[model samples]
Target chain A: MASKPECACGDTSAVAGGKKRIIFPCAGTANVGLISNAAAFQLADEGYGVATCIALLGSADTGLRRRIAEADEVVIIDGCPATCGAKIADLQGIAIDQHIVITALGIDKVYERNYTEEEVERVVSAAWEGKGRT
Target chain B: MKIEVLGTGCMKCKRLLKNVEVAVQELGIAAEIKKVDDITEIINRGVMLTPALAVDGEMKVSGRVADVKELKEILKG
Candidate 1:
């Protein structure tokens, strides 16, 4: 037996339109960076949020500020443990609903041809699962 | 080809720009490298990743800079 009621925040929101979901990717120069981008892309494709680069967020002329202010949910994907994406969001004072670190899961840091899309997808799913908890 | 490494001038972006230049020189290709710090233009490129490398008008790579050898291959292509 399962309940059929729908929730927007997966909690208690009824109307689900323009929730303004946004994802920030660290996009560093390592395996974790690629994973972060992959995860962000998947999240955006899944309609969880708009996938905007953290760098863009840091430099945009108040556009990033606007996105942060209007975003109902903000997700950050940082490669490795540096957490640059998270740091950027923190500096912007934007509360992140989901923060994902690929290397934190025991995956060795790498770049170039050593990384696989499957691993990135796994991390993205994990981030998605952790959503709305922030 | 004009290549631009887009980032907030982070170490990674700088490093990638260096690699791109090295590759271009090694391959004896004629290109100029530019660093873009404008967030609006970066976002306009629809790149959701930093340390992005653009070849000419196309985004050749993003998130990480490829190795010198790999960069050479990409540039040669």
Candidate 2:
């Protein structure tokens, strides 16, 4: 029996050559917020990027901020127009290479507790594709 | 009493700082208030949100700006 090949999509080191791409998700209390979080986690798990804490960024942690400032790229995911995650990065003068808004993807912003796997997959694909970049 | 406010000097962070000052004054407490504006230092302290309050190195409030009333409760504790 032949062994299955390892997925290169999950090899972050190989993709970035040791550089890190950070992702920040709003993770708000809304459905879209949760979807953003799910997408971010999926991207991290797939080695597309490292999912860092948005709260830590908001707190203005010098180390984390420095890491962001020096990162090769930064991705921000917002559940709604509030753009909490992106705003935090902006406050610290960190530039966002890509910004994804779940609501802008045609997902309604509601208080649902659960989201479909398809929705999560859509977000993951968008992030991986670096959508919302000019 | 030692109180530390963690933030990067944003509007909300400044509001939190003001609230803390007002709280301390109203309570007539002798406290050492410090503003942690350095991002590296803020991260080392394990704060995940801005405008956070730490009492004697212990984190208490985070993420949101506490009103004067809320600050009073936090300082009192």
The number of the candidate with the highest lDDT is 2
Residues B13-73, model 1: lDDT tens digits:
6656767776788899888889986777777777666667788878887665444666787
lDDT of 2 at A49: 68
Per-residue lDDT tens digits of candidate 1, residues A13-89? 12323245677888887777877787788766644567887887777549778857866777788777788888877
Global Cα lDDT for candidate 2: 0.75
lDDT of 2 by residue, A1-134 (tens): 22321222343344313336798999898889899888888877755668988999888898997877667779999999998888888888888888888888888998987899998877776664445553
Tell me the deviation in Å of residue A119 in model 2.
0.8
Interface-residue RMSD per candidate? Answer: 17.5, 18.9
- Candidate 2 chain B: worst-modelled 10 consecutive residues by lDDT: B62-71
Model 1 CAPRI quality:
incorrect
Poorest 10 consecutive residues by lDDT, candidate 1 chain A: A5-14
DockQ of all models, two decimals each = 0.01, 0.01
Clashing pairs in 2: A55-B48, A61-B39, A61-B43, A62-B39, A62-B40, A63-B40
Clashing residue pairs for model 1 = A21-A49, A31-A110
The TM-score obtained by model 2 is 0.57
